[model samples]
Target chain A: MNETSRAVGWKPRGWDVLNIVLLSLLALATMYPFYYIFIYSISVPEEALKGVYLIPRGFSLQNYVHIFKQDNILWAFFISVARTVVGTVLTLLCCTAFSYGISKRNVPFRKLMYGAVIVTMYISPGLIPWYITMKSYGLQNNFLLYILPGLMVAFYIVLIKTYIEELPAALEESAMVDGASYYQMLFRIVLPLSIPVLATVAIFNAVNQWNSWVDNLYLASDLKLQTLQMLLYTYVNQQTAALSMINSNSTAQTAFVMTPTSVQMTITMIATLPILFVYPFLQRFFLKGLMLGAVKG
Target chain B: MEKTAPRKRKIEVPLLVLTVPFFLIVVLFSYVPLWGWSIAFVDYVPGRSILESAFAGFKYFHRLFDSTSDFGTVLRNTLVLSFLHLICSPLPVLLAIMITNLRSGRFAKFIQTVTSFPNFISWIIVYSVFFSFFSIDDGMLNKLLYGTLHWIKEPSNLLSDPRWTWWFMTLATVWKTVGWTAIIYIAAIAGIDQEQYQAAEVDGASRFKQAIHITIPGIMPTFTILLLLNIGNMLNVGFDQYYVFGNALVQEKIDVIDTYTYRVGLLNMDFSYSTAAGIFKSLVSVILLFTANFVTRRTSGRSIM
Candidate 1:
C-alpha cells in the first residue's frame, strides 16, 4: 500500500494527522466524564471532589457494601434481570409471529396490519394515555407491568418481515408440498433460516428493555419492583443518608467518604453489563441487520 | 424470493390467524388509548372511570394556548433547544468523518468505542459529572480558570444559572449522544463506492475537494433521510436527560411537554388536562411527520412511509 501510495504521487498529509489528533482529543473529552465517575465511585467521597486525579487515595468496597445494604439492590437486580429476559422472549415471539404472518404477501389484510404497526410507531399517543390505560387495567404493582407494555414493537416486526421476505420462496413452497403445516414450515425452515435477523431483533429488544426506566417511573411504585436505573436515581439524587452526612459540620473529606458514587457507577456497569456481554457476539449481525433495513430502497 | 403454489394460490388462514395475538396487543395498547384523548376535556380523577370525569371541554387546551400561561416560554424553549441541536448535531458527523480519514482501522474504532461509551451511562451519572465541573466550590473548570487568572472566589454554579442551563443541557446532550448519532453517518460514508474516489484522485483532486464533491454527494440520501426523521421527531426533547439534569431554578428554561405532562398528570393528578396536553403533542408530532414525509417526497422522491 505504501509503495502504491508513492507510485501514485500520494503523500500522507499533515492536515490528516491534525484531524486525527483533534478527533482523538474530542473522543477523550467525551470519555473523561464517565472515567471521572468511575474514579469517584471507588475513592472515599471526600477525596473524590478534591481533584483525586488518576489514583484513589483510599480505594474501598464500602460504597458497594452500602448500596447492597439498602435491602432492595439485590431484589432490583433480579427484577431487572427477569424483566429483560422475559420481556425479550415475549417480544421476540410476538414480533416474529406477527412478522411471519405479515411477510406472506397474499395474507388477507396484510397491508392494513402493516399500516397499523407503522402508524403506531410514527405516532405515539404519548405517555399520559399509556399510563392511564395501564393504571385502569390494574397492571400497576404487577410484575407483568414490566413485561406487557414492552412487547410487539412495530419496527422490529417490520425488520423481521423484510428479512423473511428476502428468503427464497421455493424453500417454503417445497416444504408446504411435503406434508408440512404452516407452523411446521415457520418453525423448521423460516426460523432457522432467519436466525441472523432473529438474533438482531433479540439483541435490540433486550438492550431496549434493560435500559428502559421512564415507564417504570410512572407505573411501578412498589419498592421491591424497582429496576436498577430507578434505584440508582433514588440513591444518587433523593437519598438523605448521604446528604445529611454531607451537612451538619461534616468535612468535605467526610462527605466524599460517604457518597457511594463508586457503587453507583458499579450499578451502572451491572445494569449495562448484560448488553455489553452479548454485543460482541451479535456485533456482526447487528451491523448487517442495521444496514439491511437502513440502506434498502 | 419465495415462490408460491401456482394452482390458485391460497391465503393461509392459519397464518393470518396468528396475527390475532399481536392485533390484540396493538389495539389494547395503541388504539384503545386513543380514547384517553377525552381526558383533556374532563377533570380526570383517579379510581373513577374516564367516562365519569367532570367535563371541561377545551378548558385545559385553552389554558395551554393562553398567552398568560408559560406555554409560550416552553414552546420557545423547545424550539430553540431543538434548533440548536439541529445546527450543532452535525459537528460530530464531521468529527466522525475526520476520524474515518485515518488509515488505521483499529485507531478509528478505538476512538469510536471510547466516544460512544458515554451514551450508555444514565443521565444521572452525567449530572454528577456536571456538578464536578460546574459546582460553586472547587470545580476543575473553576480551578483551572482561577489559577490562570484569579477571576472569582468560587466556581460559577452553571447548573443553577438559567442563562447557562440550556448550554449545559445542550453540551450534555452533545457529549453523550453525538458519538452514537455519528455512527450512522460514518456508516453512510463507508457505504460510498470507492471507485468514485479513485476517479476523483486520478483527476488530481485533493482529498478535501474530493470529499466535498464526491463523498458528501454520495451520502446525501442518507443525510436527507436522517434530516427528515429528525425533523419529524423534533418535539421529542428526550425527557430523561432534561428531567435528571433540571433544577427548580432552570425549570423555566428546560421544562418540555414531556416533563410538563409528568408534573401535571403524575404529580398533581390533573389527568384530563395533562392528557389534553399530551394529545396536542401527539397531534403536532403526526403533523410534523406527515409534513416531513411530504417534503422529502417532493424534494428527493423518498418518504419515511
Candidate 2:
C-alpha cells in the first residue's frame, strides 16, 4: 500500500501538518482537565487555594489519607466491586444461554422470544414506569436491583446470538452425535467457542455496572448500598454546595489540611482510576463491540 | 444428522427449561412496565393496586398540557438540547476523517486512545473534572482568566450560570462522546473499497479531495442511521449529565424530560403526574422512531428496524 501510494505520487501537504497540529490541540484539551484535577488533588490544600494550573506546588497525600480514613468510601468501593463482578457474571450467563437457545433453528417459540427481546432495543416504558415496576418487585434499597434488571440486556443477547449463529455448525452437530446434552453442549462447546464475543460483552457490562449510579441514587437509597460512583456523586453535590457557601462566608476556611476541593478531586480520581487502569487493554473490545452493534443494527 | 433427529426432538424440553426462565425475566422487567403506563390514566395512589386505583381518566395527561404545568419549560429544554446535539452530530465524522487521513499510525492511535478515554468514566467524574477547571473561586479557568491574565474583573462560575447551561452541557456531551462515536465511522471508512481510493489517487487527486469525495460519501449511510437514531432519542436527552450538573440556578435551563419526570414522580411523590409525563415522552419517542425509520427506508432503501 505504501509503495502504491508512492507510485501514485501522493505527497505530504500543508494540510497534514495542520491536521496533526489541530488534532493534537484537541487531544490536549481532552486530557488537560484530568491532569489539572490530578495535580490539584495532590497539591497541599493551602497551596491549591492559591490555585493550581499545571503541577502541584507542595505535594501532599493528606487528601488521600483523609478520604481513605472514611469508612463510607471503603464500603462504597466494596459495593462497587461486588456489583460489577456479580452483575457482569450473571449478565454473561443469562445472555449467553438465552442467545444460544434462541440461535437454534428449531427452538420452540424462537421467533416469538427473539422478537420480544429485539422490540425492547427500541422502546422503553420510560422512567416512572420502570421505577414503579421495580419498586413493586420490592427491589428498592436492594442490592439485587443492580444485578437483576440488567441480566438479560437485549443488545448483549443480540451480539452474542449473532456470534453463535456464525460459529461452525459441525462442532455442535458432532457433540450432539456423541449424546452431549443441550446444557452440556452450551457449557462445553459453544460457550468455549464464543469467548471473543463474551469478552466483549463482559467488558461492556463490567464498565456499565461500575459506572452506573442512578440505580444507587433512586432505587437503592440505603447507605450501605451506595457504590463508588454514587459516593462520588454525593460528594460532588456536597462540595458544590459547600463551595458556594464558602464563597459567601470567607471565614469558613478550616485549619485542616484536607480541603473540600482536594478531597473532592481525590474522590473523583478514585472513581475514575479503575476505568483508566483497564481501558487501554480493553479498548479493542469496545471498538469491536461497537462495530458488531452497528452491523447488527 | 438424520439419526440424531429423534434425540434432538427429545432435547427440546430441556432447552425450553433452560431458556424459559430468562424469557420470563425479560417479560417481567421489560414488558410489565408497559402495564404501568395505566397509572398515567388513573389516580395512582402509591399503596393501592394500580387496577384498583380510582379511575380518573386522562386527568393527569390533561394536566401535562395545562398552562400551570412545568412541562413547557421541560419540553423546551429537551428540544433545545436535542437540536444542539443534532446540529453538532457531524463532529465525530469530521474527527474520523482527520484520524484516518493521518500518515503516522502511532500518532493516530494515540489521539484516538486519549480522546476516547472520557467516554468510559461516569458523568459524576466529568462534573468533578469540570468543576475543578471552571469553579468560580479557585477553578483553573477562573484563576487563569482573572488572577493571571486579568482579562476579567471578577471570577465567572460557568457551572452556575443559567444562560450558558445549554451550550455548556452540549459541549460537555460532545467532548465525552465524540471519540467513541467516531469509531463507528472509522469502521465504515475501513469498509470502503481500497480500489476506489487507488483510482482516485491515480487520477492525481489530493488526499483532501479523496477524503471529501470518497471517505465522506462512504460513511454517509452510517451517519444517516446514527442521526436518525439520535432523532428517535430526542426526548431522552439522558439523565446523568443533566442530573449531575443541575443546581438551583441552572435548574430551569437544564430540566429535560427525564429529570422532570424524576423530580415530579420520585422527589415530589406525585406518582400519577410523573407517570403521565413519562407516557407522553414514550409515546412521542415511539412516533419519532417510526418516522425516522420511514425516512431512512425511503432515502436509503434500508430500514434500521
Candidate 3:
C-alpha cells in the first residue's frame, strides 16, 4: 500500500482531486444552511449573539417546547395536516375519474375533453378572475377553500391518463367480457395496475397541498383557519404582531428564553421534516412519475 | 377502426357518470374565471351583474397604461426577474455536466440528492433559511462582514433593499431548484449511447474532449425543448416568492404583475383595474407561447404541440 503503487493504478490524480474537492464544496454549500439553522434554533440567546456558533451552544429543547405549547401553532399544525390529507385524496380521486374515462380511446369526443384540460394548463383565467370566482362560490374564509379549487388539476389528469393509456387493453377487454362495469374495472383493474403512477401523483399532490400558502393567504382570512405554511409565511413576512403574545407565557421565567428566530426555525423544521422524512420512500415513485411524463411527452 | 368490436355504450354510462362531476367542476372553476376577464371592460362593482355594469370598454385598460396603475414599474420588475431566471437556466446544465464529470460515483450521487432536497421544502421555509443568513443588523452575513471582516460601516438591509431583491430572489429560486432541474439533463446524459463514449476512448479522446464532443451535443434536444418551454412561460412567474419577499422599501423593485394584481384587485377592491392587468399579462403569455412555438419549429423542426 505504498503511494507509488496507488498512483500507478489511477490515471489522473489531479482530475480526481479537482472532482472530489469541487463536489465536496458543492455538498457543503447545499447542506451547511440547514446545519446553521439547526444550530441557531438550539443555540442559547447569549451564544447565538456571540462568536461562531457552529454547534449548539447550550443544548436546549425549550424553543421546540415553546413552539408546541402555543395554541396558534397547535391549531395551525392540525389544519395543515388535515387539509393536506383531505386535499390530496380528493384531488387524486377527481383526477383518477376524469383521466380514466378520457384514457378510453373509444370514448366519444375524448380528444375534445382532453383538449379542454390541456388548454387550461397553458391559459389560466388570470388571478383576479380566479379569486373573484372562488369568492363567488362562497369559499372565502371556508375550509373548502384549500381543497375544492384544486380537486382537478389538468396536468395530473393528463399524466394519469397517459399512464392509463399505456396499460394493455386486453386487461380491460377480459374484465369487460366478464361483465365488469367501468366502475368495477377502473377500481379493481386500472387502479391496481396504475399504483406506481398513482403513488407518484399522490406524492406530488400531498406535497403541494401541504406546502401551499397562497390560497390560504387569499381565501382563508379567519385567524382560526390558517394552515402551517400560511403561519410560516406570516412569520417569515413579519406580518403578524401576535408573535410577542407567545412570549407572555408565565413559564418563560422558569424556561430558557424563546426568541422569534428560535421559534421560526423550530416551526420551519416541524413543517419541513415530515416531507423530508417521507421523501426517500417516495423518491423512487416520484422518479418513475417523471419518466411517465418524459417518455410520453 | 374497431367497428367489428362490440360498441359498449353501457360502459360509457358509468364512465361518464364518474367523469361528469369533474367536468362540471372544471367548467365552474376554470371557465367561469375566464368569463370574469370581461370585468376589465366594465366598471364592475359588487352586487351588479357583469351585463348590467356599464359597457365602458377599455376604461380600465387605459388606467393600466397610465401612470395611475404603476403598470410600467410592475412590468419592469416582472420581466427583469424572469429574464434573470432565464439567463441562469443554463446553470442546471452546467451542474449536470459537472456531476457527470465526477469520478467518484458515491460523491456525485450524494451531491445530487443533497441539492434536490432543497426543492422539497416550500419557498416560505426557504425564506426562513434566507432570513437566518441575511436578516439585517444581526444576520449571519452581517455578523461576518461587519463584525469580523470590517467590510463596511453600516449593516445594510440586504433583505429589503430594492437593489438586492431581483438577484436575491433569483438566487433563492435557483438555489432551490437547480439540482432538481439538473435531473432532466442527467437523464439526457444517461440516454446518450455508451458506445459513443467507448469509441471516443479508443480514439484517445480526453475526458474534457469527450464531454465537449459527445455529452454536450447528446443533451442538445432536451436543452432546446426546456428553453422553449421556459420562453413560453416568460410571463407566468407566480406571486409566492415576490409576495413573501416584497416590502415597503423594496416594493418598487419586486411588485411583479401577480402581486400588483393581488393588491389592486383583492386588497383595494379595484376589480376592474386588476382584471385589466390580468388580461394584459395573459395576452402577452399567449403571444409568447405562440412565438416560442413558431421559433422552435423554424429552428429545431419541433414544436411543443
Candidate 4:
C-alpha cells in the first residue's frame, strides 16, 4: 500500500521526461545490431546489395535453408552440445567437491589445498606447453579433449566455496552429530542448499564451452571433432572462403538462395540462439548468485 | 581454535579418496602446464624427446627484443587495447546508474537484455556482423558514407583496413561486453542500505543528489575490486578475438602476444621460441598481479588473492 501510494504520487517532472527520452534512445541503439542482422538475413538479394534494408526487402527463408544444408554444421552442432553438457557437469563436480572439502571446518591440509587452488587461478602457464602436455596425454584429436582440461574451473571453485561457507553452520553441525559422514552431508545437505550457485556456475561453464574456439583451433585436428565455433571462424576470418560462399550462393544449384549477406547473418543467429534458449530457465539462479557476492563482500 | 596441528589427526579414508581425483586432475592439468616452462630454456623438437634437445637459453628472448622483431608492435597493440578497455570501464557503472534511475522496470530489463546479448556470441560469429557493416562493396558504412553523405571519395573496406584495427577491436569488444560488466555494479547498488536513501529523501535531497552521494559511493568497493583485477590482467590480451579478426594486411597493427605465440608455436612450428615468448608473457603478468594487489590492498584495503 505504501509503495502503491508512492507510485501514484510520483508525478512526471522535467528530468523524468529527459530520462525517458534518453532511455528510449539507448534502447533503440542497443538493439539496432540484432535488428540489422534480422532484416539482412531476410532481405531480397538484389535489394540487399543496393543499400540498407530497414525492413527486409523480401520475406525469405532461403538463408536459413542454405545454412542448414551446409556440410559439417550438424557434426559441429553435435560437438558443441556434447562438449557443453559434458564439460559443465564435469566442471561442477570437480569444483563442488573441492569447494566442499575446503569449506569443511575439520578438513586436514585445508589451507595448503586452498593455496594450491588459488595459485592456478592467477598463473596461466603458457598455452604451448599445455598443448605439449595434452599431446603427451593423447588428448589431441580426441573427443575427451573438450571434457578433460576444463574439468576444474578454479574461479568457480572459489565462488562455490564462498557460498558453502555462508550456509548455516548449525545445519551441517546437527547432521554431523547424527553420525553423518562427510560425503553423506555433502550430497544430502550441502548440495541441496547450494543449487543456486551450482546453476550459476553451470550456465557460465556451458556458455564458455559452447563459445570457445581456442581448444578447437589448437587441439581438434580431426574433421570429426571440430566444434561449430571453428567453422564460423574459418568462414568469416578468411576472405577467400567468404568469396567462395558468395560464388556458390550465386550458382544455379543455389540460384534461389539468399545473398552472402543473408547467409552470414543466418549462421551467426544459429550460433548465438542456443545460449538465449537456456537463459530463461537459469536467469533466476543467475540473479541470485549475482547478488550473493555483492551482499556478502 | 581447532588444532592448528593439522598433522596429528588421521585423514579420513573416504574423504581423502573422494578428493584425490580433484587433487590429481589439478596437478596434472594446471601445474603440469607450468612444467612446460622448461621448453623455453631448451630447443624443443616436436617428435623428439625434450631431454634430447640441446639447450638454447636466452636466444629466443634476445630475438624478441631485436629491432626486427614484431614484439614491440604486438606490445603496443596490447597496451593500446587494454588502455581503451580500462578507460571505458566507467561506462558500465554509468549505465547501471542510469538503468537504476529509470521510471519503468520493463524498459530497464529490456535494455539490459539487448545490451548483454552480444556477450553470449563468440568473436568468430561477431566477425560476421562486422563484415556486414564494413564490407568494401556493399557494406552499410560504405553506403552511408559514400552514397548518402559523400564523405569519402572511395569506398574503403573499414573492417580489413590496418589503420582502423585498434579502434574497431576495442569499440567492438566494449559494445559486446559493457552490459555484462554493468550487472555487477547494479547488484552492488541493490545491496546498498535503503535507509540512507530514505533519510536523504526526508531531508529534501533530490533524486540526482541522492544517487550521486549515496548510490555511487555505495558501489565504490565493487568498482575497486574490478579495477584491481583488470590491472592485474592488463598484459594478457586474449587470443581468440585477435586470431579471428586479424588478416595478413593488419597483422602488425592487430597482433597481440597470445596470437603471436599461437602463430609462432603452431603455424610456424617454432615451438621453442613460442614457449619462450609465452613464459615471458606469464612472468610479466605474475609480477603485474602482485604489484596491483599490493597497491589495491594499501588503498582500498581489499584484495582478491
Q: Each model's TM-score, in the order given? A: 0.88, 0.93, 0.93, 0.88
Over 4 Å off in model 2, which ranges?
A1-12, A240-256, B1-11
- Report the CA-based lDDT of candidate 3 relative to the real structure: 0.82
Model 2: TM-score, first chain: 0.88
For each candidate in the order shown, give its overall lDDT on alpha carbons.
0.74, 0.87, 0.82, 0.79
Query: Which one wins by DockQ: 3 or 4?
Result: 3
Task: Give the docking tier of candidate 1.
Answer: acceptable
- C-alpha displacement of B246 in model 2, angstroms? 0.8
Q: For candidate 1, list the clashing residue pairs, or say none.
A: A41-A261, A41-A262, A45-A256, A45-A257, A46-A256, A46-A257, A169-B1, A169-B2, A169-B3, B39-B272
Q: Output the lDDT of residue B88, model 2.
A: 93
Could you report the DockQ of all the candidates, in the order they appear? 0.42, 0.49, 0.50, 0.43
User: Docking category for candidate 3?
Assistant: medium
Model 2: per-residue Cα lDDT over A1-297, one tens digit each: 656455444355668889999999989999988888888888988788887877896988767766775677779999999999999999999999999888877777889999999888877887778988999999999999999999999999989999999999999899888888889999999999999999999999999999999988889889999999888777766875644443344333544455678878888888888898889766899888877987897
Which residues of candidate 4, in runs, are more than 4 Å off? A1-14, A44-47, A101-108, A165-190, A239-255, A281-284, A291-297, B1-11, B144-153, B194-212
Candidate 4 chain A lowest-lDDT run of ten:
A3-12
Q: Is candidate 1 or candidate 2 better by DockQ?
A: 2
Whole-model alpha-carbon lDDT for candidate 4: 0.79
Candidate 4 lDDT tens digits, B4-37:
4556566766676556668789899999878788
Local distance difference test, candidate 2: 0.87
Q: Give the fraction of true interface contacts kept by model 1.
A: 0.52
